[model samples]
Target: MIKTENVSMRFGGLTAVSDLNIQISKNEIVGLIGPNGAGKTTAFNTITGVYKPTEGKVIFKGEDVTGAKPHKITERGIARTFQNIRLWKDMDVLENVLVACHLRMNVGVFAATLHLPGYRAKEKKSREFAMSLLDSVGLADLAHEPATSLPYGKQRRLEIVRALATEPSLLLLDEPAAGMNPQESLELMEFIGKIRDQYDLTILLIEHHMQVVMGVCSRMYVLDYGVTIAHGTPDEIRRNPKVIEAYLGVD
Candidate 1:
């Protein structure tokens, strides 16, 4: 569903990613794993157009979307959540998701302001869709509460829910297990599987938690200092000497 070819990102003199090539097929959950400073997030930024790559191309489906604006990429059916939870703290949970669904609405600003029939109908549908998403994640009871009022795990789940509201074909999750406890992380693994099947999504996630990656991803890539060191099935990655060196500081 997505491919990056020789993708590189440099911050002035510092090269954060170098000639990274990756391919993700439809309905696959692939993991990008590495030590801190490995440029996993930078690769994601390049793909999502947060920073135009210094070199190479990013292809989604069959289109070359290199350097496309993030919103344009999003509109083209890619959605992502950040490594750190980014929620509208002041907005209620349902409102937060409803805002994302507005990307699909087909109403003029004036018509929406005037509450025309089409606008009203679309608005009602958006609300129902958002609510159904929340309900699917067991957050329906908290729909009217402030987004920041939820516990840490729920807040993380809400971030994914908001991303889902965008109706994306591919979902990029940046460290979705970042701050979760063991139990929460385990639950997130199950949740990831559920959402992949439920949404028919192709998922690529950046995660530091080896257990989470091993448990959830069919294949994984290892990076160190912006270079692709190894990529294979979870068992292969586990036994790779380079991967051990990258994570364990073994000389």
Candidate 2:
């Protein structure tokens, strides 16, 4: 559903990503894996419009969206979670998700300011939809709890749920298993697959945990120092000399 052609990002004298190319088919889960400083997040930033690529094109569903604003890209059916959890500290779980649901609400500013009937109606619908999303993800009971009160794993899940509130077709997840134990990572792998099937989503995942990525992604691309070193199925990647050398230093 998304393709990047020769995409590169340069910061003054530094090139963070170079000639990166990747294509994800509909409803497919793909992995972007590399050691720290391999430019994996840089590639995601370019694709999500956080940073405009210095060269090449980012095509989503066949349309070029290389330099579009982040919100514009979100409006075009893409949503993303960051490497760090970014839930609003003061908001409850449901409220955090509600903030994202507002992206799709059609009420005018004047109507919202006045709390008109139409605005109220839309707000009701957004709440119902958001609640359903929480229910689906098993977070409904904790809806009114402060977002920061959730455990780290649930916080990660909440961030994904908030992104889902935007109703995206393509979801970019950055290190969803960052701080989890092995068992928690295993559960996260299951959760990722469950959400993909439940939401009919195409996912691009960046994960440092090899088990999670290998367990969930059918295909992956490995990068090193701003260059794509290999792209293939997990088995192929595991056996690839270039990938091995990138992740495990060679003497």
Candidate 3:
């Protein structure tokens, strides 16, 4: 569903990602794993248009989408969640999700001002769909609560839910397990799989948590110092000397 060919991102004298190539097939979950400075998030930023790569192409569904604006990418069936939790603290959980759905809502200012039948209908449907998404993620009862009131794990889940509100065919999750406990991470692994199955999504994620990466990803790619070190199944990655050396600092 997504491919990056010879992609490189540079910042003045520094190269964050160099000649990176990754391929993700439909409905498969792929992992990008590496040490802290491995440029995983940089790769995501380039793919999502946050930073245009200095060289190479990002192709989505066979079309070159490199350098397209982030919203344009989202509109074209890609949605992403950041490594840090980003939410509307003042808004209710439902409201937060509703904001993303605005990209799909076709109501005009004139129709909204007149409360036209089509506008009202669409608004009602959007609400229903938003509630359904919250419910799917087990957040329905908190629909009226402020988004920031949720605990950390729920906040992470909510961020993912908000991304889903964009109705993406391909989902890019950046370090979804950043600050979770072991049990929470385990639940997150299950949650990721469940969402993939329920949403029929093709997933690509950058995760520092080896457990989550190995547990959820059908295939994995390892990077070191902004370069691809190894790519294979979890088992192969675990046994790879290069990956071990990168992570463990072994000779």
TM-score of 2: 0.98
Task: List, residue by residue over 80-99, the lDDT tens digit for candidate 3.
Answer: 99898999899999999999
Best-fitting candidate, scored by lDDT: 1
Which lDDT tens digits does candidate 1 get at residues 1-251?
89999999999999999999999999999999999999999999999989899999999999999999999999999999999899988899999999999899967899999999999999999999999999999999999999999999999999999999999999999999998889999999899999999999999999999988899999999989999999999999999999998898884
TM per candidate: 0.99, 0.98, 0.98
Best by TM-score: 1
- How many clashes in each structure? 0, 0, 0
Q: Candidate 1 at residue 46, lDDT?
A: 96
lDDT of 3: 0.94
What ranking of all candidate models by TM-score puts the best one first? Answer: 1, 2, 3
Q: Write the per-residue lDDT of candidate 2 for residues 83-191, one digit (tens) a residue.
A: 9899999999999999999899977889999999999999999999999999988999999999999999999999999999999999999998998999999998899
In angstroms, give how far residue 37 of model 1 lies from its true place: 1.1
